[model samples]
Target: MPRFMGFVRMEEGIGMPPQSLFDAMDVYIGEQAAKGVFLDGGGLYGTEDAVNFVVRGGEVSRVDGPYAEGKEVVGGWSIMQFDSLEDAVAEQEKFAQLHAEHWPEVTVVATLRQISDGPEAPGD
Candidate 1:
């Protein structure tokens, strides 16, 4: 199985919602966990909590990000192992739909990154 990292893009100005809504979402995530497909997932604070960095003139400068201009920012992420890209995409679609219903204006990009084994460590 291939591992996937799911980035969740979220809408603007959606401060905390009612407690019940969070509870419902918790249940949904719990269901995923029960299925053994869920590796990890969590939400994030807003853009203010972000930081961006750039390098120039042999110096490193820092700025707040996920790059400001975008309509949606990566609010959180999840890691999962799936059999194929199609399976990962299906999960992304499911998450996108849920995000749409909760935050209609948000846009999402679910990317797939491959992890390969590197050189062995000194021990074994």
Candidate 2:
């Protein structure tokens, strides 16, 4: 089975939503988990808590966040396993729909990406 990561990106200045929103999200996530398709998921703190490391030549430098130029940052993520990309996408659609119905006032963008298996082993 192939694995996929579904992530949410939010624009700058977006803060934590209301308790009702969180409750609704929890119910949706719980339902998905019960189906045995959702592997794991969690939300992240604000971007101010992030750090970026850059390497140039032989020196390494660290850039602290509160990234002013960043238009959006990952807010949360979910990992799931599916038989194919289409199946993964269909699952994501359900998540998106939940957001659409529960948080219609807020703009949320969810994206999905397949997880790579890394380098293959030597010939069998």
RMSD of each: 5.4, 3.4
lDDT of 2 at 120: 52
Candidate with maximal TM-score: 2
Consecutive 10-residue window with the lowest summed lDDT within model 2: 115-124
With a 3 Å backbone cut-off (N, CA, C), the pairs that clash in candidate 1 are: 52-63
Q: Write the residue-wise lDDT of candidate 1 on 45-103 in tens digits.
A: 78776787779899999987555576777667887777777777787777665655654
Measured against the true structure, the TM-scores of the candidates, in listed sequence, are: 0.68, 0.85
How do the residues 3-121 of candidate 2 rate in per-residue lDDT, one tens digit apiece? 78999988867666777778888888888789777899998888887999989998999999989998888889989888778888897888888778777877889999887787753
How does each model score on lDDT? Answer: 0.66, 0.83
Q: Which stretches of model 2 miss by more than 4 angstroms?
A: 119-124
Best-performing candidate as measured by lDDT = 2
- Candidate 1: C-alpha lDDT: 0.66
